[model samples]
Target: MDCLISVDGSVTVSLLKSIFFIINVLFYLNYILKNNIKKMNTEPLNLVNGKIMTLNESFPIVESLTIKNGQYYSLNNPHPNFKTINLNGAFVIPGFIDAHFHIKNLGQRLDMVDLKGTKSAEEIENLIYNKSKTLKSGEWIEGFGWDQNLWNDKNFPSSELLNKTIQNNPVYLTRIDGHSAWINNVAAKVSNFDLSTNIEGGSIVNDCILIDNAMDPIRNSMPKPNKDSTKKWLLSGAQYAAERGITNVHDAWQSPEIIESIIELVQENNFPIKCYGMIGGSFKDFLVDFFAKGQYSGKQYKLRSVKAFIDGALGSRGAALHEPYHDDHCNCGLILISKEEFDELASLCYDNNFQLCTHAIGDRGNSFVLDTYQKYLKAQNDRRWRIEHAQMLTTNDIGRLKECSIIASMQPSHCTSDMKWMKSRIGEHRLHRISRWKTLLDNGIVIAGGSDCPIEEGNPLHEFYAAITRTDHDGFPKGGWQSQEKLSRIEALNLFTKGAAIAEFSENNRGMIEVGYEADLSILSNDIMTIESEKILKTDVIATIVNGNIVYGNKNF
Candidate 1:
């Protein structure tokens, strides 16, 4: 007999004992693992009597949800750990995320003079004049948010006038779009420039303003905020965003120093909002090796992406268009970087697991970016190569965005803010393709709604209102700018919540409300899904919660 092969007749006593031991250990491990998961499911942190959007296909919406520690724990399961409160039918949904914003710039702008909403050139001059009076000699007066499009005259102001008005100190006022800088003679001289100061991917418009990269001189000349100052500023910005129901943000542009400051925030547990930072494009070549990719979910700050500007903004006439601007016939707009350079950078980013989010705001610029994205990334791969602002696309490139599997990170409020003047820049013929959000969606491109914030109001509600209505604050144009392209309320909601999360690569954990998901939520004044489109604008964010803890609004509830 083959004694060694037959278990009953020839198996050694020691071998049988070892086999039994191994089976028992695996059985015990399986039992413990299942029990641990069951504990996660049953752990209680209750909130009852609510109208929740949920955003999960299975649950869709729920009246109650239970959370524990930092996660949802269970949906519809009675949680006994916390006191239950009746919400009186206040609508709750996944937390709003401004998918593209400058956290540091927002903080810095908080300290600068408010140049927004100025109707005339004289008002800006007077404001600068007043600001200069408070400052000592040789101090720089910095301001932002002035728009020539909103001015009745609609002309870029000359630096000669700006110099004469604020003669005591140097002045630098950035355009509403942040793509152009208006400087006084003092600043111009300090930066060493004149009307003929020519730089590619930017312009020295009227000798007073520096557009795009040309403003580098002024940027280098300015005093940088230290880590302490950055943390303070960022905290203020976080509180501000929390109040607005923004639970998360994509920090679109952070320098190397700024990136370290964020690390400090994470270490101290001081970062208030979920920060998905992009080491800004200018520092890409230098910082790529400095910041290795995807240290995802360090609790709050995750550097999983890179931001690049392909062109300046349309409002600044620097949005690299195929045709010259209707208003400015001679200029074809600015191309910030060559495609050859972008392709190599994108390849490196891809290998490093970083999402390459390129900001392209014109037809030509968007086309160029889409083409380059196609060149490096395969069609079927789940690479979320994004086009920030993707404001304009040619007829041929409409489906190309979907074919390349790109996410359109759009600022919905840009429609309302820019609609009044869009005709003058791109003309009515190209209007259909501008912010063709509906078109993009129909062809299967994910639209990640955002507010380029300091560029527009960071209110998630305002973004929702603009996206669905496609109208400005006063609700002009009767029906909407490109009424055909307007999105539904639920669609808009998903854009800010689910799409935003997906863009940040946190969709599985953060976007939806269900068991096993994090409890990041936004309670609204009314049910946005069923509310009137105009009432959507009136909808207020009642509360915001991040990681099962309330960050804004009533703590008692």
Candidate 2:
């Protein structure tokens, strides 16, 4: 990850940071000189004209953009001699950055059997039944996006029920949150498991469904998606993101092989979007070698951190809560790891100067993680470690985030997805405690927005619509679930731009439309800033520019 020392040479992280800073300053100076077209010295290639929202307070709006060396050289000072393409006053903004997406999962899911919006268990069975006809004996049938909570019965299924439809092959279907899975009897035998067996942080509910670590072994048994397929899926995923005006994505919990492939893609310029990866926990053994290498920053890739899971997601009722679940009163939840284990890992990361991005969801989960963080961090340091999710927090735990300077890498679409059933699972009292975007920002905590794709649609506009409005797909609860906690459109934009850049420790030059900032921008068909909140979702991307190159859109300008 982005550690201090390097295995290659004497190139230190501090030295690299200095180099990047110098590069920013130099580029800014270069842009300013070339942009002074009033003198008319240098000839520029293409000039773009539109209503550009720089997101920089110094200069909020610009009429024209001068391009040189594929960078936003200057604003409003276009050369009279060069071709200036006008957009008929389209709205342009900085390319959106998804702060908590997993590129590998998105690619993997592209090839898997989809179960996203299946209304009931019967629908899921019917979907799997059709796929079973094509599978041979002993072959694994894998599917994703099954939510028991979304079903009519709102209860877990049995292995017998799964066995009835998926008789030919062992079938395993993952829950929407990815924290749980439902399996058939054949898969149970294939997984070498007994229903009576006990696991630490996961469970086999109703003798069929596996939660958290319990699902890992079965998942591992399934053949991995090949590199070619991965590349194909990644290309499609990237195209979708680019079309929606996404410039960069955080590839959370990536494997070493995928990371290497990503590196190759960047080198070959085959990767579609700029990817920032978080090494998965399975590669803990490679931490020393990985950390020694420090940061890998190329045109399309950067691996700067390690990822770990502290507890299960709240959706599967596996989140480690301080109290028992309101729905299942007998069960509190699952704790994926021990306090000592988390502390050991935290210390390892802290000692090696690596960023530890832990996934925490429930109240107890957040508390335990914060305590571990406080133990190692006696004094505040610039260790930009993040709490991925930081979903559920008590009233007292809010300030601890500011004290530790932990970045809240949250997905806005999660709120809209869960709001329909949030109170049913957590009870009314606890409902008032969670996801408080405004409260988090009000207490000096830094927030970055995203769509945890494969779980929720990774559309930037959908997330922005949710963040600013705090409403569901149907625009429920007219005033919003908690209107008091809503963020403004500008604040929501920053969550995907500047706020995201700060979380990634790249705020010096990126996130804003400045002379030094990377010329990664998104142009839209409509002016979202002045439009009504409901109409924000109607805004279409006219073009997407990354590093000043048109990667998506037919609007050649």
- Identify the candidate with maximal lDDT: 1
The digit string of per-residue lDDT tens for model 2 on 1-557 reads: 45656877455866676456444433432343344312112234354557989988988998778766556677778867665667678898888999888777776787778999888888888888888877778888889998877888888876667777777688888899999998888887776777678888888888888899898778776677777766666677777788889999887887655765565455456665777778776565455555655555554566677888888988898888998999989988888988877887888788877788889889998888898988766546678888888888887888888888888888877877888888989898898677788899988778888888878889999999888888886788798886777888888888999988887777876788887567788888878878988788888888887776678885444
User: What TM-score would each prediction reach against the true structure?
Assistant: 0.90, 0.90
Itemize residue pairs with steric clashes in candidate 1.
none
RMSD of 2: 8.2
Report, for every candidate in turn, its global Cα lDDT versus the true structure: 0.80, 0.78
What's the residue-level lDDT of 160 in candidate 2?
Answer: 68
- What TM-score number comes out for model 2? 0.90
